[model samples]
Structures are given as structure tokens and as C-alpha cells.
Target: MTQRTDVVVIGGGQAGLAAGYHLRRLGVEHVILDAQTTPGGAWQHTWDSLSLFSPARYSSLPGRLMPVQPGRTYPDAAHVVDYLADYEKRYGLPVQRGVRVCAVHRDGAFLRVRTDCGDWRARAVIGATGTWTRPFLPAVPGRREFTGRQLHTVQYRSPNEFAGQRVIVVGGGNSAAQIAADLAHARIDLTWVTRRTPRYLADDIDGRALFDAATARRRALDEGRADTGGVASLGDIVAVPPVRAARDAGLLNPKPMFSRLTAAGVEWADTTAAEVDAVIWCTGFRPALAPFAALHLRGSRGRVATDGTRAVDEPRLHLLGHGDWTGPASATLIGVGRPAREAARQIRDLLA
Candidate 1:
């Protein structure tokens, strides 16, 4: 028998969980379909030494607070997974694990979601799968000829795995910095490479003070008299300086963009050669929407196109944990609640 639901949320990570929680509160009948056997999504696959950059206070699902130990700066990936599991139990969110969605198509007024388990008929769908689904690996020449074990950061776990290997950590994001630092502490031979220098932020900041200054700068930019540069917001400005400091410490270095990969290892644009035993591509991810090709996605640069609060063109489909009012935080546990809540309200109104 084909099951029916008011909504079918794809992905069982923080964003999907948040959406499910909100829908449950509104008495909406929905089911969450996730590919992973667990609920934490990417966190379940993160490097073992990873920790949240945002504080616990900001890292909670809607209507639930992340349990915290006193004086703990931030929680580790394990703690985060535990929190998500608990949230699922508390809310009794109906999630089907190990159910990989294969395709989504419209059937008259209903949306048909086909998975490995079976087919579901839903009135609407929430694409909460997030932007971290597909890891973006640049196509460098001779990449296939590399004899080294090349893997994405998603597969990285602990430094113990790369104990004595010569590792080349690619990309300039937070993941690259953290992984390089962790490997270096383990006495592993590590080299960090990126196309451009990254911006890192302080662990703590005066929120109000920074907000005031940022507001002033935004106003100046809007007035057309001053240039705000390419910075999107305060977060971008705050993160730049500290990352440069890490670079100066020899922890991070900008390589002339990736050029080619040889059987011996990798060759950068400057003709420099690094014989790596393992290559860790810290490249970022994109949204996973392969199943919903029938919905006609409006994506640019591999991201779903939305008009601030709603998905473009597709009325029955909405995107959560995407860039709406927030930046990267929108995709994190700390920042997903607001967007999830907003999406729930819209869904409720649509069903009503």
C-alpha cells in the first residue's frame, strides 16, 4: 500500500528534524525520509576531532535547548549527534531511516516521492537536505592518475588513520584549518593548500558592538557613498583577520590554484610538486536534489534559487536550511531553527 502524508521531508539532519518538529506542533501529518541510518546527517560523518564553532546556546532545534556541560565552550560532533537523537525521541518525529529517495514527481494534485522502501503521496515537500550533500571536487588535470589515496573531508575521521603519512589538506575553509591543525598536533606531515587566503573569526565577540558597527557600514553602502567591499555581513569581516594569522603561523598556505594531479601525487599552478600519501579535499558541498527533478529546480552555482523566503517557481516545494536571512549559520544547528519555524508556518497555512 502506498503511504500518504501531508508533507515528506527529505534528509534527517538538523534542518529536517527542525521542520518535522514544527510540523508536529501544528498537527501536520508528515514523514521525514533520510538516506543515513541515523539522524545527525553530516555530523555523523564529520572528522572525529570536530567541534562546533558556535556556542551551545545558539545550537538548538526549535523548542528544545541543546544540553550543555557547565563552562564547555562548544560541543563535539558526538555530543551534537546525541542531542539530535534525543530531539527525535522527545518529539516522536516519524523518520524513516535508510530510505534513500530515488525520485519525486507530481501526480495531479499530489507529489509522489519514491524511495527504496516504497512510494509516498504528499501534498507538499520540504527539501531540507541542505547544501552539504555533494562534495565539490575541482577537476584538476591528471587527478585520476594520482596513486595516493584521495578522499573528501567527509570521509576523514581521526588523525590516527593518517598517523605517519604525508597529507595534503586542500581548500581554505574552516574544515581545512581545523584538520591541518589537528594533524599537525598528531605529528603527522601535513601541508595546507588553498586558492585564496581564508578569513577566520575570534572565538568570542561583543555581539551588540559588532552589530552596531555593521549596521552603520550597511547604511553607508546603501547610501551609495561608500563601498562595503565584497563583504556580505559582519561575519565575513570578523572571520578574515584571524584566518590570515593562522596562515602566518605556517598552518595554512595559499597555493597557485590546483593545476594537475600525477601518479606521484599533485602538482600546483606554480610547478611545485608535493608527494602526498593521502589527499584530503576540504572542498565544500552543494544541495542534494537529484530526486526532485520533476519539480524543475531553480538553481544557480549549484544552489537552489529562492526569493529570500520562498523557492522560486515551485510553490509546493520549499527549501529549508538554505541562505534566506542567515549565512552559513542557516545550515548549522545554531541557525536552522528560525528558517525551519518560518517554513512550518507557511506549510501550515498552505494545508489550511
Candidate 2:
């Protein structure tokens, strides 16, 4: 069946839900297509111990705040998943689950979102598919030759599997630190790898500071003022409780990134090598814009060139929460709402 909607949201995650909230508030006819059978999108697949860097008050979508028990502070992945399911139900958002969008093709005036279930002819399309499904795996020379078990952040679940094994964790983000920390007490020997020395924020700081800094810089850009936010980026690791504890325990011994991978393991930058059983790549992800491949809208490094969240070449297309380029800190739960709201407003105008 061909379903016609004024706006078609490609994801039903935090970004998509936020866009739906705004579109409904503005009275735009829209339908949300979700690939996952349940709510929470990528959150459903995250590690059980994964926790947000902020409290419930700071981590919320547009229109509604995440509810938490008074004593329980920061919500974990399950809490987020539950809240997302509740959010969708509370707003009565039109979300169709298990409808994986295969392609997006432009036909004359409208954009046709082709999914496994049906097709949607939308005046505007919102690409809120965040970068979770596509985990970035580095291409080391002997990467394929390594016989050890390999996994990315997307596939990682628990530390039990690598309890007594020598594991090499790659990347400099919170995921790398958290995973290493989780494995530290499991009697596992761990080696951390980073391209550069990771800069960390103070112990007192968390996502609140990150959100504020990003919001300020984004506001400056929106107001036509020079971005004077300096080299302060939200990507810098924050000294979260667990991460700080790991550092204090002398478990965060990170070496400069390795040069190449051998049959046993990676050769360190200093030419010293170690025999490891597994390597966990925490290197971030590129946007999942495979459905939009027919549009030829992607530029260098698979990035969509956007004027804010709207695709430059295709004005009716809005990509929300892809990254900072799409909108400042647009990947964060708190920061995503700004871009989602703005994109929905812009999409509303386009449909009108």
C-alpha cells in the first residue's frame, strides 16, 4: 500500500521522536517508520551496563522530560528504552515498527520512502537514523590476517567473555574507557589505544557542560557571530564517576595508537608488540545514509552537506542528529532535540 504523509521520519529514536513531537505540535501530518521491532532504537542494543553521562533532567527529548525514581539519578540504557516506549505512547505518535526503509527516491515533486512494509509519499523527509548501526572499523594492514576474535562497539555486550584474556581496546572515547574499566576487575589484561592523548574534563563536569558549550557555539553560528568557543569540543572525555575511578585505580594506561596488525595482535607505535586475544574497536561511526544513496547527496567521507539540518541539494530532506556538522552535538540525547525541533519547523514550512 502507498501511504501518503506530509512528513516521513526515517527513524523512531530520540531524534525521530523529537521531530515527531514538534511536527505534531505544529499540526504537520507525519508518520514515523522504525526498523526495530520495539522502541528505543539503538538503545535497545547497547550494553547492559551502559549509562548516560548525565542525570534524567539533562537527558530528555523535546516536549517531555524523562521520568526517574527520586533516588535513582542517572538512567541506564534500559531506563532510556522504557522512557522512549512511554514517550511514543504518551504522545500518540504514529510510529510503524519493523518497517525497515530500503530506499528513498524522489518522484517528481514528492519523496517516496520505500520500506519493507509499504511506501510513503512525503513532501519532506527527516533522516534521523543516528550512527549506531554502522560502527567504524579501522583498516590496519594485517587486519584481516589476525586470527583473534574482533568486535566493534556495536557488537560488544559484556566483559565476561574476555575475563582472563589479553584484550586491546581501541579508540579514545568514553566507550573505550568504560569497556576497559568493565574488564579490569575480570582478571583481564587490558591495553588501551588512542590516536592522540585524550583530553578530559574535570570530575565535576558532565553532559550539562558539554550541552551548554555546544549550545552557545551553535547559537553564535545561528546569530551570524564568529564562533569563539575555542578548541573546546564536546567530544573530549568527561571524568564520569566510573571513568575517574578507573583512572584513579591506574587502569587507564593508554598507549599511542598502533601502526599495524600482525597475526597475533597490533604492533605498538614504539615497535613493541603484544599477543592479544581480541581487539575492540570503539572508533565512531559514519552516518547510515545508504537509503539516500540514489539521491547522490553525500559529499566527502560520506557526509551529507547540509545548511543546518536540511540537505543542500535536496531542500526537502532534513538529516537530524547525524553529527556536529548536521547540527552541533546533534548526536547527544539532550543536544539532538534542538536540531530535531528546528528541522521539523523547517520541514513544516517546506510542506506548506
Candidate 3:
């Protein structure tokens, strides 16, 4: 079945929900197509011990503030899921769940969004599909030959299964730090590895500070002032409670990345080898853009070039929640609001 709408938001996550809220406020008729049957978005798949870098008051969507969790300083993944699910319901957003957008092609003046359930033709399309589904695993020699288990962040649930095992957690980002901390009490021989020395953010800094710094940097650039490097200049890892405890206990020390995977484990350039039973790659993810592949929008850097959230090659196409490329800190719950509002406003103009 082919349905028609003024706009079709191609995700129902935080980014999509934010865009839907703004579109609804602007009196734009739009439908949100979500691949998942639930409303939590990517937060639903996060590990059991994951916690937000910021407190509830600092992490929220455009119109709603996340409620504080009793006895907890920072909210966990479950709390975030609850908040997102409630946010969708609170706004009464028009979201059609269990619809997977397979491809999006131009159909004259409208964009044809082909999905598993049906097709939708809309004047504008907002690709808010986040990156959780597309976990990035680097190609290391002997990876396929490794006898032990290997998994990425998307597949990681809890450290219980890895208790008493020799595991290596790879990456230099927040996920690596948090997962390493999660495994600290699991009675496992854990090895934390990074491409470079891990840098810890100031204990007082959190997502709110990062977002404010990014905003200031953006404003400075807009005013042709000297560039004040924002979060990038600060550090990579956030000292969440778990990470802090693990660091204080000396369980979060990281070794340099291994040169290559070995049949039994991994080996470094110095000829040092370790027999790891499992490897949890906390490496990051790329944007999930399979539906937009038919549009041929990727530029030289393998990213869909955009001005703010609007795709530069396709005026009616907008990308959201991918990363700083889409908008500064847009992938964060609080940071996505501005870009979502801007995308909705542009779509409104385009439809008008």
C-alpha cells in the first residue's frame, strides 16, 4: 500500500521524536516510520550498566525534562528508555512502528519511502535513523581465524557471561571506559586496550558542559572569532560513577591497541601476546544510512554532506542524530533538539 503525507520521518528514536514534535507544533502533517516495535530507540539496546554522563536535569528532549532517578545521580539506560517511550506517548506523535524503510528514491516532486510494511510518498523525508544498528569493528589480521568469541557494543548486554574469563575491551571512548568498569567486579582478567592513551574528562564535566562548550564554539565561529575548541579539546572519557570507581581501584588502566588478532588472542608490535578468551570491541558506529543508499548522497568522506541537518545534494532530505557532522553534539538527547527544530522548519518551508 502506498500512503501519502506532507512529510515522513524515517525513524522514531529521540531524533525522530524531536523532529515530530517540532513538525506537529508547526502544523506540518508528518508520519514517523520506525523499524522497532518499541519506543525506546537505541537506548533500549544499551548495556545493563550504562549510565548517562549528565544528570536527568541536563539530559532531555525539546519539550520534556527527564525526571530524576531516586537514589541515583545519573540515569541509566532503562531510565532513558522509559523517558523516550513516555515522550513519544506524551506528544501523541504519529509513529507507525515495525516499519523498516528499505529504500528512499525520488518520485517526481515527492520522495518515495519504500518500507517493509508499505510505501510512503512525502514532500520531505527526515532520516533520523541513529547508529546503534551499524556497529563498527575494525579489520584486524586473524580476526576470522580467532578461536574465541568476538562481539561489538550492540551485542553486549552484561558482563556476567564473561566472569572469570580473559577478556580484552578495545576502544578509547566512553563505551570502552564504561564497559571496562562494568567488568571490573566480574572477577575476570580484563585488559583494556586503546589506540592511544585514554584521556579522562574533568570529574565535574559532563554532557551539559560539553554541549555548552560546543554551542559557544559554534557561536564564536559564526561571529568570525578565534576557534575555541569545544569537547574535542577536553578529553574522551567521562568519569561516570562506575568508571571513577574502576579507575580508583586501578582496574581501568589501558594498554595500547594490539597489532593484530592472533588465533588464541592478540599480539602487539613489541611481540607481546595475550591469550584472551573473548574480545569485546567497544569501537564506535557509523550512521545507519542503508535506506538512503539509492539516493547516492555520500561524499568523499563516506558521509552524506549536509548544511546543518539538510542534505546538501538533496534539499528535501534531512539527516539527524548522526553526530557533529549533522549538528554539534546532535547525537546526544539534549543536543538533538536544535537540529530537529531546524529540520522541521526547513521541511515546513519546503512543503509550503
Candidate 4:
């Protein structure tokens, strides 16, 4: 079947929903296509213990803010999922679930969104498919020869399953540290690995601070001014209560990355080998841009080249929630709305 719309927003996650809300306010005819059965996008697949790095006030969409209980703090993954589902209902955003967009090819003046369910031809397309599905794990030598279990953040569910096992958690980001902490408490022998020493943010600093810092840097660049400083990014783990607790318990220490994967385990820089039952890689992810592969977008390094969310190659195309290249902290909840609103305005103009 084939349908037509003024705008097609792909991926009904926070970014797509935010863009949908803005488009609705502008009285634009749009439809959001979600690959998943439910709303919430990648948050539904995140590890159970995951929580927002900032409080609820800082994690909201354009017009509607995320509600928080008086005494409640940062919301968890489940809370975020519930909120995304609720947001769609509140705004009456037209979301068609279980529709996986296979590709967005040019159909003359309009774009043809080829999906599993049907084809959607739209004047504008917003690609908000986040990176959770495209997990990245480095190709260490002898990796294929290893007999032990190898896991990425995508496959990692909980620490309880790894109880009493020798495990190595690799990556320098929050997921790696958090998983290590959880595994450590399960009485598992855990080793934390990073390419370099992990930098801990100030105890009071959180996601908001990181977003502000990114904005500052961008502003400096835009104004053609030299910055007197550089701030850490989202990778800087929030010193949340749980993280602090883990620190106090001496479980967050990180070691340099190992050289290669051995049959039993990994070989270190000093030519030392240690056996481990499981290796969990929290390395990172590339943009979920398979649908746009035909577009031949630039910026090969896990991000799309965009001038404030507008694709450099395709004027009617907008990429969001991939990372900061689209907008300052665009991949984040609070930060995504800013770009989403802007992108929606541009899409409306294009359709007009």
C-alpha cells in the first residue's frame, strides 16, 4: 500500500515525538513511523537500571515537560518509556508503530519512504532513528578465536546473570562504568577497561552541565571566538547516588585497554593474559542510518553532516538524536527538542 503525507518522521522515540509535537503545533500534516511495537524508542531496550543523568525538569520536549513527583529525582528507563508513550497520547501525534523504514529513496520531487508495512511518500522526512540498535565493538586480534561469551551493551540485560563469574567490562563511558559497578556487587570478579584513564566529573556536575558546556563550545565556534576551556561530554558519567556509592565501595577503578583477545581471555600491554568468562563491550554506536544509505550522506565517523539538523546533502531531510553534530547535545532528551523544533519549522517551510 502507499500513503501520502506532508512530512514523515521516522522512529517514534523522543526525537521523532518531539519533532511530531512541533509539526502538530505548526498545523503541518505529518506521520511518525516507528519500527518498534511500542513507543519509547531505544529506551525500551536499555539496561534495566538506567536512569536519566539529569532531573526531570531538564529532560523534556518542546511544549510539554516531563512530570515529576515532589520528592522524586532523576527518572529511570521505565519512567522515560512511560513518559514517551504518554506524550504521544497527550499530543495526539499520529504514530504508526511496527513499521520499519527500509530506505528513503528519491521519488522525483518527493521522498519515497520504503517500509516493511507500506510506502510513504512525503515532501519532508525527519530521520530520528537513534543509535541503540547499532552497537559497536572493536575488532581485537584473536577475537574470533575466543571461546568465551562476548557481549555488547545491546545484549547486556542485567548483572544477576553474571554472578560469581570472571567478567571484563570494556569502554570508558557511563555504561561501562555502571555495568562494572553492578557486576562488582554481584560478587563477580570484574575488570574495567578503557582506552585511557576515565575522567570523573565534579561531584555536583551532571548531564545539564555537560549540555551547557557543549552549548558554550558551539557558541564560541559560531561567534569565531577562541574558547578559554573545553568541557567533558555525555560520556562523563554523572556522579549520581549510585555511582557515588560504587565509588565509595572502590569498584570504579579503570585500567588501560588490553592488547588483543586470547583464547582464554585478553592480553595486556605488558604481555599479560587473564582469563575471563565474559567480555561486555560498551564501546559506542554508529548512527542508525541504513535507511539513508542511498543518500550517501557525508561525515563517515558515526554522524551525519548537518547545518543545525538540516542534512547537508538533502534539504528536506533532517537527522536528529544521532549526536552533537546535528545540534548541541541533540542526542539527549532536553537538547533534542531544540533541534526538533527548528527542523520542524524548516520542514513546514519546505512543504509550503
Stretches off by above 4 angstroms in model 1 are 203-258, 299-302, 324-328
Better structure of 3 and 4 per lDDT: 3
Q: Model 1, 1-352: lDDT tens per residue?
A: 5899999998899989999998898899999999998767778888887777555765677888988845565678888899999999999999999999998888888889988899999988888777666888888788789998998988888889997899888877677777777777676888777776655545454222343344455456557867553223433223223333455567555455568888988886778887889989988876666887767774555555664335667667777775432222457675577667777888889888
Question: Any runs in candidate 3 off by more than 4 Å, and if so which?
Answer: none
lDDT of 2 at 57: 87
State residue 119's C-alpha deviation in candidate 1, in Å: 1.3
lDDT ranking, high to low: 3, 2, 4, 1
Error of 3 at 55 (Å): 0.5
Clashes of 2: 0
Local error of candidate 3 at residue 214 (angstroms):
2.0
Best by lDDT: 3
The local distance difference test score of model 2 is: 0.86
Q: TM-score of each candidate?
A: 0.85, 0.95, 0.98, 0.96
Q: In candidate 4, what are the lDDT values of residues 1-352, reduced to their tens digit?
A: 8999999999999999999999999999999999899888888998877778889888888787888835558788888898899999999999999999999999999999999998999999999998888888788888898889999998888888887688999998788877877777676789998998887788788778888988888788879998625466434677776777888898778889999998889999799889989999999998888999887885647456788899988898999878877888889998898888899889888877
Query: Which stretches in model 2 have alpha-carbon errors above 4 Å?
Result: 69-71, 222-226, 229-235
Candidate no. 1 TM-score = 0.85
lDDT of 3 by residue, 46-139 (tens): 8999999999999999999999999899999999999999999999999999999999999999999999888999999999999998999899
Better of 2 and 3 by TM-score: 3
